[model samples]
Target: MAPGVGGAITGAAAGKFFSWLLESERARPPRVFVSFDFDNDQQLKHLLIGQTKRQNLPFSVVDGSLKEAAPEPRWKEAALKEIRRCDVVVVLVGRYTYKAPGVLAEIAMARSEGKPVVQLIGSRSLGYTRVKGAGKVLAWTQDNLTKLFGND
Candidate 1:
């Protein structure tokens, strides 16, 4: 092997190694999309939002009420787009949430996209209809969420 050529190869390797090292160190976390029945309860939305912020998870809450205008049915398409882009989908189900059309649509879309869907049945028992097709159902509490997703 040529001595000078060896130095060039080694220098190139070191430069590439350092670049990857820095990139990994500063990498952004994956996003999670939170879906819940907007008509269900204010307290649930507030708690979920607070938990997301506290954990520093990149996320967007899909609440139609927060927007300035009424949501079109196509908004489901937009919302699912966000869900597909995210690494995880968190479905919070209260009594009202389970019965809400929007929440049902969101859950089905998320499942269709093959995203990891975690169903949180909070403080409420779901009727057989609501529980029938759920792939994974977990406790609706914050602690259970931490368990499923891993605490940050």
Candidate 2:
């Protein structure tokens, strides 16, 4: 092989290898599937999502869209699929969250999929109901959220 051609090929290979290594090293934020009371706390869910955009939190909320899934069976299936895709599940606890059937089902699905569940207190007011089997709720905060998702 010509000396110039050999050097050029080796340099190109090294550059490609370096790029690949960097790409693997750069870990994207965790994919979070947020489960919230759909009927009574849609606004709370929106607010949480808004924080993700504005604060640039260390997690991306996966749009499971289980609420729109047709029929009860399909909804469960969709929930399971979405939960499987996410690295963790974040349940937004509201005043009526404990009674929400959809939220309850989603939480169960998340558990079945073996995803880590992080419950956040959605309402600041007292007397908010916490969902059962969803673990204890933590006060929502940027640092808290960052740490939760950063655990990976």
Candidate 3:
């Protein structure tokens, strides 16, 4: 076999070998699925949402006319489906709001799905408890998250 192909096969074998070693800890840390909008909340939502996109990991966000004056229940279904598919759910909490009721529902659904949760706060507004299974809640500024995630 050519050297390149030989190296490729060897690397694949090594990868598979290492993958098997971590099979027992599959439930730890977990895959993260994030939810938010770009234009709607801007800062908080944008920060976490932006970092997720930059990471190139598998994640989904609310899309389409869900931002309409009156949202359809189907939007909730779609969002929950994404939340259900992930092992972790990260939400962005922002200001000038009572909080996004829909996103909150998504978090609850993630809990129902047995996914750990994480949140990055975009504002200083207080008066909420971290979700029970959430891993970490960071006071992340939108710009800082963008830079830290290397999306800046």
Which stretches in model 3 have alpha-carbon errors above 4 Å?
1-31, 36-40, 52-70, 96-98, 125-136, 141-152
Selected candidate, larger TM-score, 1 vs 3: 1
Estimate, for each residue in 48-112, the C-alpha lDDT of model 1 and write its tens digit. Answer: 77877777444344443334324666677678778777767777667666577766677788789
- Highest lDDT among the candidates is held by which one? 2
RMSD of each: 5.3, 5.8, 8.9
True-vs-predicted CA distance for residue 35, candidate 3, Å: 3.4
Computed on alpha carbons, the lDDT of every model, listed in order, comes to 0.66, 0.82, 0.56
Query: Model 2 — TM-score against the truth?
Result: 0.77
lDDT of 2 by residue, 1-152 (tens): 97799899999999999999877644777888888877777887788889999986777988786554478898778888889989889899888888888888888888888878878998778568767888767989888888888734
Per residue, candidate 3 scores C-alpha lDDT tens digits across 1-152 of 87699899999999998898776445333445665433346555555556666765333443322444455478777667666655556665544222556566676777787876667665566544454334567776545443333311
lDDT of 1 at 111: 82
Higher-scoring candidate on TM-score, 2 or 3: 2
Q: Model 3: C-alpha RMSD to truth?
A: 8.9
Query: What order do you get sorting by TM-score, best first?
Result: 2, 1, 3
Residue-pair clashes per candidate = 0, 0, 0
